[model samples]
Target: MTLTRQVVSFSVIGVCSGALTLVIYVMARDWWSPVVANLVALTAATLFNTEANRRLTFGTPRRRGLAHVQSAVLFAAHYALTSCALLGLGVLVPAPSRTLELTVLLTATLVGTVGRFLLLRGWVFKKAA
Candidate 1:
């Protein structure tokens, strides 16, 4: 059941994130635009991720004010790391078109995504002992 939930949860989130990525890429065309777009997407994902992660990923109830705040802070750090990577890729790639830039950024983002998921699993979304 847990594995099933994890797969389903990840799939849903992936689809949601993909949709946001497409919209953002179309709306903003530039080397660094995806970074900006990612920031926007991250904000949206945060809210969705936090709630979903707690219940589905960790079986954690909706934590109240202070715990929520703590989780948000941790999530910010995790998100910033990935966002910065994408921005750095934008600078490093020197791509001529937005499509090319996004390609580079997405490659970088893949590494960051794994890191983020591990961190969230081990730290942010872990069940209380």
Candidate 2:
């Protein structure tokens, strides 16, 4: 697929997954800590994101197992980035509001999204040559 198409598709999937993450985080936060809630949210979103990107963005749904493993690595990186942002916000604000926390996370996710796209295109979903 062309880079333009890939980007658009990936963005669409990412937006949907991000919304899912936020919804899950909000619900989970009522029962658990922010970190734990974030973890649960990311885990669920990652699974959906990886599969959607494989089929819709990259069109490489043939190797499901390998794609998932590779995406898991990507997920770990994203989780680290987002988690660090949240932690840093906590350190800075002491007791941040939900809006603040979500803002920080959204910013981190946006930054990570660029790297994720590159990795997905050049690494995870690279066409065999």
Candidate 3:
């Protein structure tokens, strides 16, 4: 697929995956700390996003073992960013509301999405130019 098409496909999948993450976060928010909730939600979403991006965004037919490693790395990177954001928010607000936490999560996720796509295109699912 063309690069443009791949981006569109990724965006589509991302929207779905992001919503899933948000739902999971909301569900677990009361029971868990924001960091823990974000980790759990993103872990599930990352699993789905990795495979979907592999097949749909990059259109690769063969499985590469490195893909799993790449996905794990991506998730770690994402988690770190969101975790830091949450930590910063806590420091700034002292006691943030759920809405604020959700807002930070969404913003952090967007930043991570951009980085994730770059890594997927340039490294994880690299194709001949």
Candidate 4:
């Protein structure tokens, strides 16, 4: 697939994943700490994102195991990025509103998405020689 197509697909998947993450995080937050909720959200979204990217974005449906393993590593990085954003928000504003927390998370996720696209293209889903 062309680079443009790959980017567009990745972005579309990312938006869906972001929405999923937000929904899960919001729902899970009622029962768990923010960090734990974030972890749960990220875990689910990352799995969805990885599978979607494997078949749709990169057009590589084989090697599901490797894809998931690599995606797990990426998931860890994303989790750290978003969790730090939430933690920093708490530090900056003790009692921040839910809207504010979501804003920070979305911003952090957006930044992370760019790097993710690069890694997905160049590393995880790259064609073997």
TM-score of 4: 0.97
Candidate 1 vs candidate 2: which has greater TM-score? 2
For candidate 1, lDDT tens digit of each residue in 1-79? Answer: 3767765775576557655655665565444355566666666656665566666665655454544566677557755
State the C-alpha lDDT per candidate.
0.60, 0.92, 0.91, 0.91
Q: By lDDT, who's the top model here?
A: 2
In candidate 2, stretches whose alpha carbon ends up further than 4 angstroms from where it belongs are none
Off by over 4 Å in 1: 1-8, 28-35, 62-90, 93-95
Model 3 scores a TM of 0.95
The TM-scores, one per candidate, come to: 0.65, 0.97, 0.95, 0.97
Clashing residue pairs in candidate 1 (N, C-alpha, C atoms within 3 angstroms):
none
Worst 10 residues of 2 by lDDT: 55-64
Q: How many steric overlaps does candidate 4 have?
A: 0
For model 4, give the 10-residue run with minimal summed lDDT: 60-69
Q: How many backbone clashes does candidate 3 have?
A: 0
lDDT of 4 at 100: 91
lDDT for position 66 in model 1: 40
Ordering by TM-score: 2, 4, 3, 1
lDDT of 2: 0.92
